[model samples]
Target chain A: MIINGKLVVSSSPHIRSVESVQSVMTDVLIALFPAALMAVLLFGYRALITMIIAVLTAMLVEAVWLRKRDIFNDGSAAVTGLLLALILPAAVPWWVVVVGSASAIIIGKQVFGGIGYNIFNPALVGRVILVVSWGGHMAGDIWSTPHPFAFGFDVSTVTGATVLASPEKAVTFSLPEMFIGTIAGSMGETSALALLIGGIWLVYKGHIDYRIPGGFMATVFVLGVVFGGGFYGNHLMTGLFHLVAGGVMIAAIFMATDFVTTPVTPGGRLIFGIGCGLITMLIRLWGTLPEGVTFAILLMNALTPIIDNFTIPRQFGGVNNSA
Target chain B: MKAGNVYLQDLSRGIINENPVFRLLLGMCPVLGVTAFFINGLGMGIAATAVLIASNVVISALKNYIPSQVRIPCFIVVIATFVTIIEMVLQAFQPDLYEALGVFVPLIVVNCVILGRAEAFASKKPLLRSLVDGIAVGIGFTLALGILALVREVFGQGTILGPDPDSAIQLFGAGFEPMGLFGQPAGAFIALGLLLGVVNIIFKKFNIK
Candidate 1:
């Protein structure tokens, strides 16, 4: 609209839009806000501090990698930093958050040729690096209880095993409380309601396809109903419990839906979702670790090319050449 | 005199140009396996070098006698003999390194570096040239392993020559938290891969390849 008399040099077959890397990443940032707001409200100022440190570190690391002075560059590093911070415990040491953010940018994003070229969710990569490197800090009976509306109180004082690790902890908090964002989990992943709101926003904006999240959630529910084995009174409630607990909500909503790492075809997206849920349930129900969302998505990310090939559509009205 | 310089080049080639680990990527089995610890990597490198030298000298001496069709099996027998001898020597003398390396010590027989040199260099060249090649390649492999192990150990464990408290020197002091990832098996791959990238950059800059 503004190119009234300008010398415009345009290429063939071009479609214009206001959206860009910055805008899309900004949308993701906006969607992540409710969960982040909920984290600070639930955890305290420490959560806010951790998020800031992570974002700053991620931006700094990416800038250094690109050899550019502009720290925010295209803002994807900020999105990665915030996402990585949200998955970590609120009371985690600041240095761990800094390290995770830096690694997310450098190892996860840049090493593979930056933002759109990375094969795994950068935030999840950072989280997994922290999980593998510092198991004591990342997991175990160190999860701090969330105290909603109390910003000044220390969250680290009250620690307990996550509901996934011990069903008894689930009894201490009701189903409604868990749904409403007051639960002992990661900083941003506790509030299923908040994450769902963000997911709905992302879906409404057409930035994310519903099939990936839908298939992922459905499979997790089915497996939980079958093998979760009445951990919280009934099989169906157990299914619901699995949905809200751990990193399932945040992972299904944000991490699994990563555009670069996931399949591009419509059919392949569903398969990828189902595969993630299956591996996640496998690890949660039987594996030594209480959570498997990060590893599940990453493992499937590694198979994206094969999944895309398998789901490629046949030419219309043509004989099946390979078949 | 030119022939002597040519022989010297043969001895020096493996150190950079034909490096087994960095250049050819041969014997990855041990390169990835034993390079996690400084002492283990150096010991493994030395042990394999010994096997390489012995196997190279013996294989070149017997090249004319060995039948062409069964040369592969003949080379294996020669390499395996030296590997067994080295394994026994390590087990008898350096029990700690033997324990650290464990099955990797016996794994040198299949190490492509030794068998590769035996087939490629020793079998074709004369005994003296073969000996020189062995020394060169052995030094190269040892240097690569030592460098890789040092990188992993310093960052992963925060100490050089660790696992023995009395003589270990801590590089970062008590305030540092070593990245436990570097100590894991996956860390070995990442460290070696990054090292190769840096080496490639240097080689490209210097036009070594």
Candidate 2:
């Protein structure tokens, strides 16, 4: 074909989707609202403060780095900032929020040549740095106990360990309570029901592929049954508990399905999800840390390119003599 | 007039234009290994500088006599001799610094900056010019290590000149929490990468190259 008296030749993927970066990012923000609302409702006003600080700091840093006036218009930076805030403890100091948000924008995204060029999920990168830098605040017994429906409650009064941190105490809490937003953990990770609602919405909107989350949860369920002891009487119940525990729901559903950091091929997405599940279980079962979702997804993000390479389908009518 | 300017240029080039750590990226083992704290970086830099100067002067004086095919071995022998001398001197007098530096003091023999200068500069240049190059390169390496250590120590530990925990000067107050990762090996790479980027930007702004 010729255009403007010049030959126009391009690779496959000639039929492009109508979705823009802004539209996709906006859909992600919409999908995240339920979890964000649950976080504020569960943790009180401090959670809102943390989220605001994170999102604003991220946008400001991106704007400064890119020298663009309308940084928040793109919505990607806000999504990253909000996702990072969701995974952090509600009791985290204001400075930690500022530093973590700035690092997510500057070191994680901008340093890698910005947006689609980044290798890892920018939010996870910031969380990892925060975990490494301030393990005391990011993990361990720093989780604030949620006083659900009490928006006026002070966050400083009540503090408790996460379920993963104190499994002996956690065993007393019923499955329904865990599924609701009554557990002590990261702001958004406590409620499996809310996260599932958001995740399903994203899936319905075609913002995320189900195969990756499906493969991820399946691997986790199988491994949980194999590794997780029968704490709730039966192995199946224990596996379900593992599925609802920690950051598995949020990470598998939201983080692993990231468009840029995840594999492009359908087969590659399955492999990527399985890899994330295997690493997460390994860390939870044998590693020193209680939670493994962040590292697991980041490690899988690093392998995305290799997975894409192996899973690339042969061209139409291409030679298959090697097979 | 031109001769004096050339000599000055030789001294300044290594300090910025051809910085071994940031520019040439040589001797990364010691640079990354010992730059966790300010004092360790200073100790490593000074030790490497002493060895680099002695090796460069000796190699430049003996370059004509050494066979071209066996020049590398000759350079190693010369550099190793100076490193051993510096090692003994540090152990006898500065025992604390020697202990802090550990195996890195002896490992200076294989540092690319010393051997790199011997092969690339001293082997080709005259003795006086080679001596200037060695000193200039040594300063550059010291400056690079110092800058990295400063950033790492301040952010990682919230202190400066942290040779010993007792004598370290605390920059932050009691409420301040230091970023512990900055004090680890990973922090060294992050600090070095950011510093290298900033240095490159500054070099471009001023047309240093």
Candidate 3:
């Protein structure tokens, strides 16, 4: 197990990179905290209840499935549970939460081997399944009214909903509102600021390669400009809103960057991220459904293996690139 | 007697042992895509069966005349011609069913069941036997589609044999409530999966190995 007279006991390169699965998972959870808090502020007590319920349900589902399969090593189940909870709307019913978690764990994760082996993000799969099965309930008119202990703001009964909830209605949200992350949306999408904060932390900690989020958001912004016209501020704000609003921020920072599911090479990752961004923008602009990030991520997830195959890094001193 | 036996075998094979959807797992794109309604399933199955049977007979009769090197292209041309004819006929006479069948009508040319039967059975068989084989396979495809449609219609949309969703009728001469989920794509997948499972079990129990 030696290389070039360098006595090697472990493996190739023998230069260990300073990153572990637990730390990376922790960073992801930490990154999501700000968005979670903003969701609490906007949606009030109900959001908290749903978040707790979703997280616990997801965890239980993952644990039970993992135990049944008799494989225990990584804490991926907890991540799935956490991600699922974050992506869910505050108004999602307890039963739906349970069912969604089960679907994510059983079909999304377990069916395709398990944990890191899943092709698509488990949380997106769960959310989409619930959305399809219980469309009426999930998409119904339910908003978080304000609670007591409010400052002079009296922000109660914001009559709030996601930006994409009604595309026909004229949206007048300012850049500051979107930037500060006070927008009305999913549990993890209330605050763009919070997501940015978390994303920065992930990058600093080296939990994820920065190129993915950078590439993905850039593609989204470019596509938004191209399709939505050069109303730069409005388009930028909306694109950022879309990024922050539903699962985009959470997905981009955490889910889409899944080590096992995403492409290994830098070029492949760029292509994958751009594809996700473009698809999401298209669906948002024209498709029947408002949010397409989850579907886009899943579709790209299915293509990751193929993308890797085509973008494999050349062997050192191998085939000429010009040729 | 031997030739007759083979024809009978081919006829029965598609209906049961080699059911295009449940047994052989062929033509899944349409099975899952178009089985939103029972009528849709029936229409699609019948249309596909027609193309399958006609193409099989034509290919069988012309087997000798076709060059081995160019047989696939020739078979595809034959199949595509029948599919186009079916598409046009449906469009002209049954516009509603035509609308419901949609792009699937033309897609029958690519359906593996028709091509598979031609390559495996028809080319080697006599004209009479090939016709029987085609009919059998077509009916089998139809039966599978029918079963899928029945389950999907009953469970997803909650109507067994009724008018369109906008229109309604009674169940057993009374009123009926549809399970609208069955009308959706997810329900189609679950129903198809369950049907595949049930067919597998029945085959196992009957020792159809």
Candidate 4:
């Protein structure tokens, strides 16, 4: 076919931009870097080892699945691996990390036809699998005490329960400490500051929609204040604590905002985010699990298509609202 | 059909072409619910098969007498009668298995495979053909359960039979950590999905669809 007397290899509506998948993925990696760096700083060399294994395994699995020589194809696998590692405890065995990352690439992504076709975030899928398969290693009291700058020692030797794991101990840890990232929790999730910085970067670059995170955080804060029982402190303080604790910060910023699994429409995204928060708080307060971000986001992810369908924008002059 | 060919085809078709579990995807609840252990799944398969065969023979013989307008109710009554017999026998003899299978044994009455065979094959066919069809379909369902159970139990529980230390055979050493997912309901879905994918690829290759 010829377009304006010139042969064209592709179809129309091809608005070429500088943002190839490689560039977008590279940008995402950059956004995730501060959190990943903070994980290593907080958990030491163990976190670093876990991160490397996860990233490598994810990339390798993707490459093998696609039968491609390029292991760094688009770099989404790398992002998934790093994200998976962030939510996992520093004390998990090397094999668990390997298995988690491999399963993330296979069952989470590839099984759903890869990349954009998947409904749930691959990293969260891996985390849930690890959580269910090895609850003792993944959850329980495995949250390692952060040894900032002590990157050489074994982090697992000084294991303690996370603040979310024990509300009674929540009074001991200050909000500022949790804010600054030195807390007993999963590798990257402890550092609310680091995650916020990454999140701000992603938002500034126009990669993520602000409404989703805004809605998610707002809902969590509101629910925490209402139902959080003031066990650790005042209602407002408990709300603040819920916002910064466990996987809430990390999931609100990274996992829930995933472009593929999340709703595309603005209104739909807000609904999705709020739904995620509702489920998260419901589980945290009443459900058996200490944190419910993974299942919350996954459930919302399953509803994404429906959300998008319902939120289709009404036409300018249309009296009848088709949506 | 030739005399020998008719018998063989009627028997073999249900094993592959009209396999109750794999081909027809009938009776999914038990397939997903009870296949956590090999012994439980095999036991379920055997129990369901017994009821299926009995109902098929009965339904084929009674097809002429039963009115078409109320065929479904008649089928249920026949199927339920066999299920009760099987359920009582299991309870009296294999008490452990009866407990292991739990609600699933009685559920065999509503199992779509048995009812489906009765409605589609047994009601229209002669006694001998319906009986042969029942046997074939029963084998297929059992075989499917066995395969699914084998996969789930070996990887999920790391044992065969009942996960019993004395009786059950452990496939892996102590260091082996079974995927706990296989032990849960979600694992059943994933296992079934992956198996279905492989089966689909085979079907495509053989032009079976």
Question: Which candidate has the top score in DockQ?
Answer: 2
Q: Sorted on TM-score, highest at the top, how do the candidates line up?
A: 4, 1, 2, 3
Model 4 residue B122 CA deviation (Å) reads: 0.9
The alpha-carbon lDDT assigned to residue A66 of candidate 4 equals 99
Query: For all the predictions, what are the DockQ values?
Result: 0.72, 0.79, 0.14, 0.69
Considering just chain B, what TM-score does every model have? 0.98, 0.96, 0.92, 0.96
Model 1 chain B weakest 10-residue run by lDDT = B159-168
What is each candidate's fraction of native interface contacts (fnat)?
0.57, 0.86, 0.07, 0.50
What is the docking quality class of candidate 1?
A: medium
lDDT of 3 by residue, A120-149 (tens): 788888878777766754553443322322
Residue-level lDDT of model 4, residues B67-139, one tens digit each, is: 9999999999999999999999999999988998899999999899999999999999999999899999999
Question: Model 2 chain B — which ten-residue stretch has the worst lDDT?
Answer: B183-192
Off by over 4 Å in 2: A1-18, A316-319
TM-score, model 1, chain B versus true chain B: 0.98
Q: Which CAPRI level is candidate 2?
A: medium
Candidate 4's TM-score reads 0.96
The CA lDDT at A252 in model 4 is 95
True lDDT of residue A282, candidate 2: 92
lDDT of 1 by residue, A1-323 (tens): 67678686789657778889888889999999999999999999989999999999999999988999999889999999999999999878888898889888877889899978998889988998888788778898878788788999887787767778876667667788888878788899999988999999999889998878898899999999999987787899889888888889999999999888999999999999999999999999999889889899999999999999999877779688876
